[model samples]
Target: MSGLTVTLQFSGGAELLFDKVKKREVELPALEKFLPQINKTDWSLRELLVWIKDNLLRERPELFLQGDSVRPGILVLINDSDWELYGELDYKIHNGDTIMFISTLHGG
Candidate 1:
């Protein structure tokens, strides 16, 4: 089987770390490329994060990624809906899906 292509969007200052490309389509290789331990055919957001960190992220990934997922103040939206509504990092990304990451900065 071929890979899945999805749209990634960065905003609310998240784009700064991604070379200022607000939106881009990425073709994620087969899940086996990332997880060869099992027969999983879907890519989870957690896996996607690792992929972005390795491929797309051009700057400090620490700012955009914390641990295994996005930083605390970064909001994740899947297809215009809150990612929380769809299990956040556990959400299985599909082809053509639009995933957006928005950073929330607090001024002191």
Candidate 2:
């Protein structure tokens, strides 16, 4: 199967959980990489969260993920638009899409 390329950005302290790397261009498999456990063919933010946790996340996963979704106070944007506006976790991922995660839990 082919791959879907997407841009991922982390900021507002979210990057700290990803080895402090703020930007990344990732190519995810077109088919569900986790089979049997996941029967879906398309990739969604919900699945991406698991993928990130298993692949991208370096440490302290609790800081980035709360259950199946991102921790509270973390803002997620897809293609520069709010993830909530795009069906949140159910949104289907497309090639060349940009996903950004920003933590709002930090103090000034």
lDDT of 1 by residue, 1-108 (tens): 346899999999999989899999889988887768858778989888988998999988778888999988999999999999999888989889999999996547
Model 2 Cα lDDT, one tens digit per residue, 9-86? 999999999999999999886564564377778888998898899889999998989989999999999999999999
Give the TM-score of each candidate: 0.91, 0.93
lDDT for position 67 in model 2: 88
- Each model's lDDT: 0.88, 0.89
Which candidate achieves the best lDDT against the true structure? 2
Worst ten in a row by lDDT for model 2:
29-38
Model 1 residue pairs with clashes: none
